[model samples]
Target: MAPSELRPVRRRLDAHEPEPEDAEDIEEYPDDGFDGRVRLDPGRRGMVALVGVGVAAVVLAGWFVWRDHPVSQPVPALPVVVTTSEAAEPAVAADLVVSVVGAIARPGLVTVPPGSRIADVLLAGGGALPGTDLLGLNLAQKVSDGDQIVVGAPAPPMSSAGASNAGTSGGGGSGGGDADDSTGKTLSLNDATESDLDALPGVGPVTASSIVAWRDANGPFTSVDQLGEVDGIGPARLEKLRDLVAP
Candidate 1:
C-alpha cells in the first residue's frame, strides 16, 4: 500500500480492554505525610476497636466488683464485763502478842503482828538492857502468840584471888587448914547456901551457889541421887560427895 492511500480506521469494542502485564506488575502508592505508610480496612479497624473497648469494660467491671466485695476474715469480738454482787474481800492477818521479861530494858507484854521474831519482840521492848545476857537466847527465833522471852543478867567478873580460893577449896581429899575441915558440916547437895557450904570437899562458893540455884529451880531434893541435877556436878564429883550428905 502507498503511504498516501493507507489509512487507519477506529471502532469501539464491547469487550473490556486488556491491561498490560508490565503495568499490572507495577504498584502505585498514594503519598502520605509519614515515613512509613500502612493501609487497613475500615471494617477490620472498627472490629478491633470494639474488641478493645469490650475488654476494657470487662476489666473495669472486674475491678469494681473486687472493690465492692467484702473480704473473708474473722470479725472482732466485743469485750465482756464481769460484774459480781459480792466483791472479793481481802485476807485477814493473824494477831500476835508476846511477853518479854528479864534483862530487857522494858520487861512487859508487847503487841506485834504475826510471824514476828524474838529480835522484833526485843526491839519492841525498848531493846536490851545494859549487862543483859544475850548468849542464852536465840534472838532470831520466831515468836508465836503468847510467847515469853526471858533474858538473863550478865555474870559478874571473877578475880584472881577468888579463883585461887575457889580452886583450892574445891579440890577433893584435902583436910588441911583449907576450907574442907572437921568442924565444917557436910553441905547439902541441893539447898546449901554458898557461905554454909564453902567448907565441903570439892565445894566452892560458885559450886555452892549452883547447888542452891538447882534447888530453887527443881524444888527440894528427896535423895542425893538428885544432886546430879546441879550444874557442873558430874558422876565422878558426885561419887566423892556420896558419903558427905544425908537424905
Candidate 2:
C-alpha cells in the first residue's frame, strides 16, 4: 500500500475512540450541611420553587372554604311554676244578757242579741205593766251587755171628777172615801198620771199630755222650776201646780 492510504486508515481509527464526560452531567460539589446533602443546581432549585407555590395555592383554597362554611353552636332552655289553695273559716256572733225588774209583767234575767235596744230588753221581760210609767226612760236607746231595767209604776188612773172633788172638799167629812184620803193632800210629781195632772186648775188634757211627753223625752223633772220646760206649762201654770205637787 501507498503512505497516503495508510494515513487515511489511522485517522478513521482515532475518530472511533471514547471522549470525556460533560461538566454539567456529572459534577463533584462540597456538602452544604453535616447531613451530607449536596447543594442543588439552579435548574433543581427552580423545580423545587414551583412545587412549593403549588402547595401554597392548595392551602389558600382550603382556608377560603373553611371561612365560608362556619361551624354550628348550641342553645338553652326555660323554667316552670306551680300554685295551691285552701279554704277559709267563718265568723260568729255573741249574745247579750241583761236584768229586768220593777213593774214589768215578768221581772228576771233575759238574753238578747249583741246590739239590742232597751225596748227589746223590756219586751223580753214580758213588757211593762199597764200602770207602769215609761216617761222617764228612753226605750229606743241601746243597752249594754249587763243592764237592769226598772219600769216605774205610776199611781192608778183616777177619774177627772173624783180628782176635782177630792181637791175641792175638806178633810174629816162623812162622805170622804177613807181616813187616808184628804182634801189638802199634795200630789206626787214623780208618780202622777195624765188624769191626775188634769185635776190642776189651769192644766187641760192637752197640757197634761204635753207634760208627760216632755218627761218621756228629757227624763223626769228634777225640780218644780223644770215644769216650765213642757210645751204649754208656763211659769204661772207651774206656780199654781208647784204647791199642789211633790217629787
Candidate 3:
C-alpha cells in the first residue's frame, strides 16, 4: 500500500460514537420516546375509547336506579288480650245478745239484730209497765252484747181532772172514755177506737188503724212505750202523742 493512501487507526471511545467517516451511512431520527413497531391506528383508538365510555354510562345509570327505588320492609303485627270470668261471694247477716232488767215485762237475756237501739232492746224484752216514768233515759242509744238495762219505776198515779168524781170501770182499774180535747181530757189508749185516735194532731187514719191492729194482736197497752211498736209512729210522733193519750 502507498503511504499516502494508508489511513491511521483510531481507538473506539466509551460513548461509542460512530467514526466521522461512517456517520454519513448511519440513519438519524427524532428523540421522542415511542416505539415505531408498537404504534396504533387512529380508527382502532377511537373505537376503544367509545366502548369504555359506554360501559361507564351503563354502570352510573344502574347506581342511580338502585338509589331512587329501595326494597320494601315487612310490617309488625299487634298483640291480643285475654280475660277471666268468676263468681262473687255472698255476705252474711249478724246478730247481738244482751241482758235486760227492770219494769219491763219478761226481763232476761235477749237476742237482737246488730245496730239495735235501747228502745229496740226494751221492746224485745216486752213492753214497760203502765205509769212508768222514763226520765233522763237515752232510748235512741245503740246497744252491744253483755249489757244491763235498767227501766224506770212507775210514777204515783195522779188525776189530770181535779175535783172531778172518779168513775171506776172494772176491777179497781179505772177506764176513761174517749178523748175530749175541748174539755182538756186525755184519750185512753185501751178503749179508744180508730176514729177517736185519728182525730189527734199527727195520728192519721193509717196510724190509727195500725194502733188498733197492734192492740188486737198484742192485747191491751201496758205503757206508752208500746206505741213505738205501732207503724208510722216515730219518736217525734210518740212524743207528740205522749200528753194527748194515756195507756
Q: What tens digits encode model 3's per-residue C-alpha lDDT throughout 1-247?
A: 7655443322334346754757877788875677566666659879999899999999999999999997899877767666547656666656766556566787777788978887898899996767766673478977655444556733222233421334332223233342222234567788787867766644555667889999999999999988988866766557756887888
| lDDT scores of the candidates, listed in order | 0.64, 0.69, 0.67
**What is the lDDT, from 0 to 100, of the residue 22 in candidate 3?**
75
The positional error of residue 26 in candidate 1, measured at the CA in angstroms, is 99
Model 1 Cα shift for residue 226 (angstroms): 24
Could you tell me the TM-score of candidate 1? 0.30
RMSD of each: 16.6, 16.6, 17.1
lDDT tens digits, residue span 31-120, model 1: 686557566666988999989999999999999999999999988998998899898988988777666766678877788887788789
Which segments of candidate 1 are over 4 A away from where they belong?
1-82, 153-247
Each candidate structure's count of clashing pairs = 0, 0, 0
Which window of ten consecutive residues has the lowest lDDT sum in model 1?
6-15
Task: Kindly list the per-residue Cα lDDT of model 2 for residues 103-175, writing each as its tens digit.
Answer: 6888777899977887998899899999777885678867655444556734334443446666655655665
- In model 3, the runs with Cα more than 4 Å from the true position are 1-184
